[model samples]
Target: MKRAGQQGWSTTEYLAILTGLVVLWRSSQLVLEHLAEHHDEFSWALMIPF
Candidate 1:
């Protein structure tokens, strides 16, 4: 019984980690798309000589 409970807890932890990773991945993609769409403005910022 104790082993089964531990297994359930482990599964839940893994699922949570996987869900977090998926959310991060999707958000990163959205950010990239936005950057691409606004590349002209972004490029101008990059051109500023340090």
Candidate 2:
């Protein structure tokens, strides 16, 4: 069987990608929260992710 890391991706590369995704998710959540607070009407849809 082929190993998962055999494609040349190292630990550091994986960590960096994970960190970037976390940052992106947090930033988006903050923006959504702000909008939900100030724009009250559409707040419910924000949590739906669509």
Number of the predicted model whose lDDT against the real structure is largest: 1
TM-scores of the candidates are 0.87, 0.59
Off-target runs (Cα >4 Å) in candidate 1 are none
* Tens-digit lDDT string for candidate 1 (5-42): 89999999999999999999999999999999999888
Error in Å for residue 9 of model 2: 6.8
Q: What C-alpha lDDT values do all the predictions have?
A: 0.95, 0.83
User: For residues 1-50, what per-residue lDDT tens digits would candidate 2 score against the true structure?
Assistant: 65777645676688899999999999999998888688877766778965
lDDT of 1 at 3: 93
Deviation in Å, model 1, residue 7 alpha carbon = 0.6
How many Å off is the CA of 15 in candidate 2? 0.2
